[model samples]
Target chain A: MSAEIEDLLKRYQNYPNVVGIIILDPFAIPIKTTMEYTLTVHYAALISTLTSKAAKMVTNLDASNELMNIRLRTKVHEVIVLPSENYIIIVVQNPGS
Target chain B: MSAEIEDLLKRYQNYPNVVGIIILDPFAIPIKTTMEYTLTVHYAALISTLTSKAAKMVTNLDASNELMNIRLRTKVHEVIVLPSENYIIIVVQNPGS
Candidate 1:
């Protein structure tokens, strides 16, 4: 299993144009890392996946600055982004069943 | 939502003795960050969760260099630990259904 994990990490490390990549659990902890990942982007990705999925499964995504977000706060660990940017933030919920 | 994420990050950061904390997706990406997480330990957390779950659901976690591991390769990203060390590696499989 450890050998397999090494191989998997190498494969993801070679992602094209990647800067940093990280792997964590639902609570937002490190699982893996690559060039395409960083402290900032890692959280963004988790949030993005969680929020996006949660919106569909729990609520909905918003666009306007003053709009409602999904009910993913509980299911997800939480992620923060820039103050005034249109960068995508996605979140995915892991059903513990 | 953004504010909520910030609060969550701060709360986790305050974890006693936490070196760093990162949140990522199954693809081995990041979602959030804290103090008690690192590149190696983060991966360990993911692997630990994944392999543990996979072992129970697919196979089981072994404790020998020349032993068999679970069948979590497909559902998990991958994680590696020192060959000579018995550090825990957890992996969690997210059922796509």
Candidate 2:
């Protein structure tokens, strides 16, 4: 799993405009992050909570539907979150770059 | 204020893909919604939480930056949240429609 994560990190880091990547456990604890420790932990916690809330919203609207992903765009960056059963991946990028 | 909300609702309802619109107070309480009552309340609570968490994440990354919007895409719909100082507007749309 560690090897796979390392490979994933390298691949995403090579992408254009990619700024940072964070891989978190099911509990939203950062397992691997290319960003500074403080910022990484902050993002891990908040993004996981956001993802869960979104999933709940989806389920409430339709019991059979599922949440695919979330794209949060701020003035400076675009944060994309992918939530799977095992882990959640957050990628922060500068879209204008 | 009520008249403005009614106009906003009417305008968004005429948009190409918009399915429902929800206007919420700063507290995430629904002020006006085109959706059913139960669904409106559900969306108001969860989306407000999502917006706040995302905003916090933005500020954490860069104290000077601000969160502009959030686009949450599920299998069936796209939920767009616009948060302002006084109100939050949520639009649920079928993008593939």
Candidate 3:
């Protein structure tokens, strides 16, 4: 699983627009990150919190519904969050670049 | 201010794919909602939390950066969150429709 996660991170890192990628645990702690330690930890904490809240929001809206992804567009970046079983993956991209 | 907000809500409600719209205060409490009471409150709480967190994430990533918008795509809905100084506007749409 670790090797697979490493491969996944490398794949995302090599994407044309991708600037950073972080894999986080259920507790929102970064397991792997292409960014600096401080930045990755910050992202892990904030993005994961939002993701869980989003998942809950979906479930409460309709029992059958499920959260797929959150795409946050900022003035300088685009952040994509993908939540899986054991870890959550977050990617920061330069959409205009 | 309220009348302007009402007009804004009405305009959004008239959009092509919009299903529901909600306005939330800074505290994540619903000011007005096109959806039912329970659903609106739920959205207000969850979406506003995500929006503010996202904004902070952007600011922390770079002092010059600012959050523009968040688009959360779920299996059954596309939620667009717009955060402003006084209020946050959330719109749920069915992109497939």
All candidates' lDDT scores? Answer: 0.34, 0.87, 0.86
> What would the per-residue lDDT of candidate 2 be over residues B1-97, giving only the tens digit for each residue?
9998898788778877998999999999899998999989888877887788788878976899999889888988888888888789999999774
Q: Ranking by DockQ, best first?
A: 3, 2, 1
**With candidate 1 superimposed using the best TM-score fit, by how many Å does residue B48's alpha carbon deviate from the native?**
35
Ten contiguous residues minimizing lDDT sum, candidate 3 chain B = B45-54
Instruction: Tell me the spans in candidate 1 whose CA falls farther than 4 Å from its real position.
Output: A35-97, B1-97
lDDT score for residue B66 of model 1: 24
Candidate 2's DockQ: 0.66
DockQ (Cα-based) for each candidate: 0.02, 0.66, 0.68
Candidate with the larger lDDT of 2 and 3: 2
Q: For candidate 1, lDDT tens digit of each residue in B45-75?
A: 4444543332232111112212123212121
Model 3 gets an lDDT of: 0.86
**Mind giving the per-residue lDDT tens digits that candidate 3 earns over B8-86?**
8998988778999998877888888889898887788777767877788789778899998998888889999988888
Interface RMSD values, listed in order for every candidate: 16.9, 1.5, 1.5
Q: DockQ winner between 1 and 3, please give it.
A: 3
